[model samples]
Target: MKTDLNIINICLSDTPMQEFIRENRILGRIISAIPEIPFEKVKIGECIRKGREDLLYENKKTGAKHTKITIEEKCVYVSKVLKKVAEEHNSDFLILDGFLHYFNGAYWEKIDESVASDCISMAAEKAGFLPVEAQQENNKKKLLRQFIADYKCPPIQTKDDDLSISVNLRNGTLKYNNGEFTLRDFQKEDMLRYQLSFDYDPDATCPQFDEFLDYVLPEKQAQDVLMEMIGYCFIPTRKLKLERSMMLYGEGANGKGVIYELVKEILGKEHVTGFSMAALSFDANTRAQLSGKLLNYSSELGGKCNPDMIKKLISGEDVEVKTLYKDVWTMQDYTCKFMFNTNSLPKETEANVAFFRRWIILPFDVTIAKEKRDKKLPDKLKKELSGIFNRVISGIKRLLEREDFTESELVNRTLEEYKIRSNTVLFWVKKEGWFAVVPPENTERKSAKVPHVELDFLYEKYVAFCKKKGMHETSNATFNERIRKLFYVQTGSTNNATWVFCDKPKEKDIPVSDDTQSPKSYVERFIDNLNEEK
Candidate 1:
């Protein structure tokens, strides 16, 4: 309900640069969706702050210390400012555009964090709605999604007894008696959300990935990985919990450019942003200019070596210049889904979490490509990709409606179908269920005799771990045994056991088969089939 309300109330807050940021295709697309909310872009005061320090000496012989005023003045020049620009446009949320900074990646040290949080919190408190932190909000979203999925709500409209309208929020598809709804009058936001699913492979080397790689060296594996990386751009509005930024990696000449090209292709010319860190080092004026626009767009900018600049850009809080231009620019704040393709070092430190969460890291590999192509992406591949993209969005929508699964669990379960993990089976079993690690059948594999989660040993061990970490105490609902699908080691018994295994079961864990065989193999088989089809 709160999310729905937020969706309805989406509008721009009083932050400068909001318009320019929103005008970007990605942000614009999100704003265009969710028509219930009004949005407007205010013409902002363009403040250009110049930082220059001149060391003056009164008397060279006297050797006296001189006062140096670090005068970095920000002159706010108004240009046809619009009041509450975001709200006027009927948007469901405000999109702020700003920069943040971190040192060695430890904590959020932004000039605007406190002020922005205070303002938003105060407003939310007055409105009896607290602004949700990303972590907390994720939990809430997960729970709500699960609730909605299982909820058997009556149709909003029912015509004949044989026909009713059921809509899947994931794909924004309406079903009339289980049939696709013919277009009558459609809303733009819903369609965009449905269309703009983010599900590409930064390492794909196929048409989906190779679409961009065609310009670079061509190889099948590289193309496939690239395709996977690029596919993620469109899944967010469908509620896919994707990382906002990406890190494309591989050796040199490995089609890294190809992967990045995929990003440029879908984000459109206007939305794809670049940053140039060297520009700031060039001069004071250059540093000032780089402050407002997207940094990743600069042709000269490369990710691996520009940690400081990237950190500054993402945090939207504080940026420091060490040279003659020791300018402290307080950036505007906003939520942006940042995508970065790099060869190495993608993790953000504690200090950069605010900015870190805004990014979804993607890696690229050129050497893995199987073939080289010089032409544009084939029409057939594009068509396949279009369908796959839609399916991915729909899958995410369904995923969001499930229980508030842990982020790890979400990753494990969602990626299970992708075969992204080679050695593990994502396992969910009740305590009373047969075994924790069920080895495959007829392969000289036997199920380990691990006790259920409620057993004395595991329960005590887990409780101790939770206590040591000061985590919340578990309740009956929290006893489900959820495990990532990873490659397991063969234990003494017929079956191989894995560390970090769970024996608990939740209400949703379904039981199967009269025989003593573990249901895991069946589950794996189903997933394998699905992957084969893909």
Candidate 2:
């Protein structure tokens, strides 16, 4: 009898047969040719006996001996079945760092190994690759391993330039260049493995974020600087050549912490890593966490840090990182930017032009009063993430066009203050009035024979001051160099390296017996005078 293939297609396209037919399209045609058995009675993987004229069906699960299909046929069928699954999911069976990842429309997301294995098993069974009889369990395990080995692709490596200027949003990828933002559909070729938790909406407005910024950074120029700095963080490439790290510094409950929270929210928590300056400097494990992060920040930055490490991080140099239970690897073109929120500057840092040039210090001076604090401000800002993201995009455009961060009066002053505070010798000199500003040549003080002090006497005073303040004093040679850089006083080779043109304090302020006074009392008196002047 002639078989009706159309009727078989309709029958198999319904209920349980639908899933099997979807996975193995060829099985539907072969099964439809058997006219003796009703379509509803046929099950996937059923054995068929081909007699002289007719065909007989027997369920493989009902202890029926096998009839026609061979193991080779099943293997081919399973391969085709899995290939379809991979195509539909848009996956190349890619692996990265020993983890399986699949494309989910917007970006590639990690898939658990167990979940992948289960999926393979189910698809194989639907494609009529199920095990039979007492060896069923063993057969299933063997089939799973075989399929996994067949489909697994080699691990892929990511380049730093791959993430440059492109941000994966929930809806699509946003690419920025010059002063324009172009949104496009996500492409598999982009190889983006991560995405922001929020969608990009250009029309969104963030009044709460604006208010927060205005409150924290009152100056328009300061706000512009902050916006530009944050915008720079979004770009994962250091091609702009702006090798500077940011520090938000103050003592009170200023809005520095709130800014950090907002940035964390905008960038998504997964893309930002929290590593203290010290940890990033000395801890290999912490550096490992920074491999794919866009920003690395520390809220409580204090004490001394390795200036060389800081320079390397901000300069986008290749850094050596070691993960737990893994071999050390070099992270090429490390692009993570640094931002620190500290109550005080580090005790000691390299005092030089290159070191200080690598830092951008923004002072947080406005402290919120207890009665005027907004308890729910952060949550309110959270609702404005989309709007804030747009603002960051705008800032990024401005930064790219200018090719630098905004330089303002407040920024310069804050940086200078931080430099002085970070250098103990400079701070001591500025605080103690140890050297006076040289007056004009025609001034009365200039012609008073320029009261000179021996270099040895000045060194003794500096040592005494350092001892009283519990600060480390620089060596005599270093002291002389720093003093020359800090003050305008002329050093004369005569009289055993005399510091000439140094004006003495008013006669009334001088001690009756300067040689008899202790260094501690002198420091106390100087401090008192400084406070009075303030």
Candidate 3:
């Protein structure tokens, strides 16, 4: 008996690709300019199989058991099986004309990557189009695929389990797993891209960021302006901490958490860590619970705390934790990127010379008047976007599989997915607004007016650490403490203050109580002496 091969295509139509539509709405306009590939409705026998027979197969070549058979029962289940077989046979053509089994509920188990890939390829091939992957040679970066294969998140078992929703900024479409919807405003994409890059590399070309925003905010200027405000972090500059730590303040609807979610999404959910600024001053348990878990966070946190503790903690100072349990933990140190959502930044904390010197405050006022939202996803663009998602997931998976990717490299690669650059990181120093430069302590803050304030301190600390054969700047907190201490000593405070800065803002000088200026500034003198010896 000749075995008949059955083909089933599962396409979610009329279900509203809410996220995809919102994004590629503009792309839809572009697509509309071009003629659509006509689709015809046809009917055929639906072969639904799931039983012991479906689970068993004999290998054609070896005459051995091919026990890894897929059982197809439900519409999605049957479609999935057909998809796999189509892929195994390298079927290049696929057509979905009529009732392709409507998804009764919103969330269903995702079809395997191979199935999605095969579907995308099949659809394109049938339309006489080449797969995007085939068009780009450099995209052969197999590491992305490997990464996704090895990657696992705290299982997102259900839609309710999804704590956040992300709009593809490129297209202005909402995305959650395979489900997508269209939206009205391009700014949502901008805000989301801002949110994602706000913590990671906020400076430039997040292809993922671009992919998200391209369809939504096509205006180069608008996207550029928004990105400038959100991109760039204070990694380290000249051996000193750059004053680039962030504090985003706005009302509830203003899109504060949106930035954090974007970062979380691209960072593979497992590698990216987040902390609520409020949780920093809350008890250790809360801090650990909020920061440690991959996704779940207490919604109660947004209202409970002020920004002062966050201010102090960012400056590398300690704060007391108010514990729910009787046992209290002194949770002061913070190294990971922090995202806080609140009505306003603490005023006094914002005004502090040290805090101001260290912090980069980006105000996300959603109420500020802007252009109206854009909404309209054409069928053709929706089809294209669905293809993009498949490629991106594939690319990322390939990146994760490479041998060259270290833990740090992998982290950076993940950030790139959202358009966050990892080459140089930005942090808020509590003294300045957001900056793109690396850790100043590591680089000797070129922008600092105070001479030798950063370097003199690093030198002294390094000497002491070497004498004891111990590294003092082990953690972000410890590294920051040394910098703040240097600022205090150089500026000459009467008591041990948490932070200090030079009195003269205009001059590149930090003066002590000596009242008169020295012949050579500390930084200048040190550099001169070192050069002379060399």
Candidate 4:
């Protein structure tokens, strides 16, 4: 009963020959009965089948026959077959964190456990380990468990350098350095785990995308900013070291939704995650969802926004994330950029300079008429993905050169307006015209006389404004502190009453500054004067 020893040799490669034979007495007995011969010339299955027939017995009374190939024996046989199959394709499989990953030519792709098990079973079946008709599924499952236990390995540790430098496109790998982009074919050494859904076609034209941008953004500067942002989303943002979240804000029927959908399509669904402001602020599980993602976005942003959490996410700080059914782990240097579209801003208890500076609010003011709205605009934009990718590349080039997003007039104006609107005290002060700038008596003087607003008068106005706007007015001490910090104004005691030395609010809009290209609000000019004096 000669048999091929190749399968046994491969399966027991890791185990001692004596140990394997002792563990499986039936297979060992069949192998021991074989005559010494070249391993490749004999078939082990034929020898095992011949030996199996000798172990069969018939029930004399009922005429029923039973074979000695028990369920346990079948599982053991199938597991050995699986081991042979696994050894043959060892380079094709990787176990990371107990998850099986299969190399699919270009990169290692994670495969579901059930899928891997099915594949292993199919391989075993092909190798002549036919499943018994009575307990095929149960037997197969047991075999898969045994195979996994024998195939365990330490997870491969992924590093930041492995994922950050190269952008994986469907066609190739794209790398950028010092304003230059190099595109090359994918290599196994690149170690990329994910890839963009679209091909990298440099000559692709996206006229529909161009038209969509023009229709939505209207201003060329805003369009450029959007393009740059989309490009920024294409790469790992932590490399840029810019910590800013973008908000597309306006009423309904605007183009914010269209832009969001287009960006998602270009980046692929797997690379982007959607989380509401409320979820991100309060849910630790939501933070875990950001792992391995390039962008985190939401269409509806509402409820209270936690400044501390928002800052941590945008600034690439370490955050604690507890994955479902896993131990708590810290996600360090998180690079996912936050982008959201909202009709109303989220409520923040403390909206300060540091918090406001991290946000870029782009106003979507244009509302397309219902009759003129294109129902198939998203479908049309999908056709131009490759061309749109080119536009994104152009933006990436410009962003790398500038080292920042395009500073548009619309963006600045919208941001400043949001800052003021979000702060009740500042909004009240701006709207009520309480603070005004006083001119210097000497034209050559660097500092101007700072006008004072009576504290009692200011507090009264603030309380009334809060009441009218349905806002909760802070205590007198808190109000005073916010005014001093936000306005950068001083306080003075005059005639037993406190006075805020913030200049009176300007009556008319000042002309745009030559250097800034934007008009300075009275509070800004006052802050500038205060800084000059210091």
Candidate 5:
């Protein structure tokens, strides 16, 4: 993946402070508080040349026409202003508008971009511009984070915080607007698309709402998935990575396509991506297409799906992405969340914790009968696109309020399935009357075809089991290594060694099922007995 230096919180002492802004009292109060920060004073009059401005927060002071501070100033002025407002108001959070005016990058060459961003965050945290709930290490980081979380100062433009979606957060609700879908600047050459006069409500609905919901997908999870997709649609900034990917699995004639269309319509074709699951691992060019996307809705998946590649994509780790016409591969953190429609789960996966953690399976077990299928349902749902979009926006607010994603029964079931699939060895051992491995003191061995077990014989059973399940067979070496790692299970060639199988916890002991659940609940799964490749 091609990586961009998006956001960092490293404080730099040598960040230049020589550039002086045209003196203004506001700037004076701000700069005096943080002398290391530097900025040039820009008034509303200077911005009047554009003939139009979208920053609602940038209101001009009446009868105030200030002189221009023309010195080459560092972009750290944003941090200074945040510090001033925070200290004066004793506020825990400050609006994002004030910093947009100082995003001028003329001094970018003179300042370290990462250090500059941190300085801003530090100033904000010190000034108490960050919410109390947010983690705090220092002032500059908190302020910079506040900017990233609620950066609205665009049309309010800044290269430092370039994002497609414009977020207007009030109270707990965030009004996500600006479907223009491209960052714009005053310079004519930098423009990608014309700023259209769009007045559509994000919460708009289509005409065929009831039939689409009732006749199409009756499952509650289907609705939750659609609403969550809509919530994700409004957020284009990839600051907070989505750790889990959505999978819509069921038989044909279900309402998968309609849900996909609703999300595609609202987020626009430019931001959503579609590809077969197999391409994710092998096709560099295909994966390249997903570079700047916000969501990947995969429909047709080929037989061979690489779990490792999918794991990397969903985990928000560094990935190597290929761009067409570019010879060398670039590394980027592809934070786009994925949702795939498949008839059945892949027969095989790495079955490791890394893979399971990133996969959220929503089984469309309920298939809409052919008799109940509505041919015009897509068109009807299309009519209520506005309404569907509105529901999604509302969903995002709920997600923000809740902040917990793994609260579904389907998630629990999917995790259970992952457990069984990952530990194919354990599953097979239990299925057969294999020699049982108990604590060293407790001697018990379930009778099976072989009275005495050897490392090779146990591996033979594992190989046959994998073939029976249509899964790739793990090597004997790997199997024996896993046995050694699992404390309960011991494997060796010695004649005295016991041919015992380690018992897996019953369904009641499942990790996610515990009544008491929190972030720590996820850690319930200990390091598995399977030997993990570090």
Candidate 6:
């Protein structure tokens, strides 16, 4: 009754007879036919009852069927069952059943295809079906991304070049002054912060440029800078090595608030959030909403922004961030450029030199009166946003044509004053008449000897200034080292370490010589030589 090769007994019979019998046997032929099944007819298990016990649970209080079940719990049980099947059959993948859609109290409901894909891909590695070892990378972010990408799904957009990668304006393309770069890697979620629409407006017209008006910036340089800010939001931040962030400062009504409001209108509420610099540094889960945002705006920045955040963003570093209920830290690009409007500057950060590189301090000098000011200015600005967007594109063109852009005199003066005030050591060096002041013999009183200062004496003044300003004082060794780097540290014959001016040459002024190098010793030696000659 059993099917076996022995039924034919080919070895015992003649060769011709054995061969003929073997050809006619059912087992001798390859599988030439397969039954086609209807799409709705197929099922992994006959009903929901056949699934794992974990899927069927009752709520403790409400007694609702399957109320205890959750995505997090169901995913674990599914991975175990799938992994067992994969190991037994050596299967690379499985066409999972429709049961994984969602658990609605008592039964499953269908979900979006993307959600289904995410559920499957997330459990792939733990199921041991993912060939991650072969790829030789274990980073969680890359691994998760690669698994989803490698598996077939609905294609949104594909981008291989990281640097060239940019947010798709949904306009189908991004046009610079010189060329057009089509948008790629257009993820709908990523654009949650791009809130501003860069949709090309062929019919949109820019308002006329007017001189002596505070509504739209009248100055060419100011106008160019504003364009760059708007244009960059459409482009990706990773494209530039360095960026300049703006801080618009002036009196009560210099149109700082209007400009800030205009930026918010252009970039929607979802894309632009009020950045409380103080709270941002201290608050938890602050970065959660900022993940996809292109710009962080603050109109009423009261004091100084945090230095640590500023330095990291300006340098294009990956910021370590966390959100509510998250156990692990996620790294996000500090791509969001900050725009601040305030009546005054905040407290100066200790690292003044590095901070100055990224800071663009612009004074809003022009103020408009009640009649002269456009009450409906914000509404008008919104209508012309598309035109302004194009203007920014043109600004990019100018930047490329000339390697350098405008730095107003106000910008230069503010930076110089910032450096002198914020930095304790630099202030003393400049004020000390080229790092050389005559040392008084008596430490008890003021020196009438000469109008110069000594290195040790200058250090005392530096420390006092820092304490009075509530700034941290560096160690004597560190202070000495920093000054030595700026100028020459002279060691006298007596093994006394003296400081002398380095006399760094410059174009504007003739280089200062080290006139106070020997001090009274030089004068004494000249007098002795004269006496010997007499």
**3 or 6: which has the higher TM-score?**
6
lDDT tens digits by residue: candidate 2, 1-534: 136887666644434533454344333332232123222223233433223212344566895533354444454455555555565555444554334555656666655554544444455555544223212455545555565566555445455454457778888899775458889998766666678878889899999788777887888888877777777876666456688888888888898878888888777788788888888888877887776567887787755668887788888887887878668877665557889999877656625556677778898899988876887888888888888888778778877788888778998877766666655666775666554334212223333354556667777887898889877788888877655544334544564364534434464366534323333333334333332441
| Between candidates 1 and 2, the TM-score winner | 2
Backbone atom clashes (below 3 Å) for every candidate:
110, 0, 98, 6, 35, 6
Question: Which candidate would rank higher by TM-score, 1 or 6?
Answer: 6
Residue by residue across 297-317, what tens digits does model 1's lDDT show? 333334333445555444443
Better of 2 and 5 by TM-score: 2
Collision pairs in model 2: none
Estimate the overall C-alpha local distance difference test score of candidate 6.
Answer: 0.49
Off by over 4 Å in 3: 1-240, 250-260, 268-276, 289-308, 315-334, 348-350, 365-534
Cα-based lDDT at residue 484, candidate 6: 52
Which ranges of candidate 4 are over 4 A from the true structure? 1-100, 113-164, 436-454, 485-496, 501-521, 525-534
Error of 3 at 351 (Å): 3.4
Error of 3 at 213 (Å): 6.7
Better of 2 and 3 by lDDT: 2
| lDDT by residue for model 3 (271-367), tens | 3445555555654555543221223211123434555665555544444543353355443222233444446444223112343444334444445
Ranking by TM-score: 4, 2, 6, 5, 1, 3
TM-scores, all candidates, are 0.29, 0.68, 0.26, 0.69, 0.54, 0.56
List candidate 1 stretches off by more than 4 Å: 1-244, 252-255, 276-333, 343-371, 378-385, 391-534
Native-referenced Cα lDDT, model 3? 0.32
> Model 2 — which ten-residue stretch has the worst lDDT?
34-43
Model with the higher TM-score, candidate 1 or 4: 4
lDDT for model 5: 0.50
**Once model 3 is optimally superposed onto the true structure by TM-score, how far is the C-alpha of residue 296 displaced, in angstroms?**
12
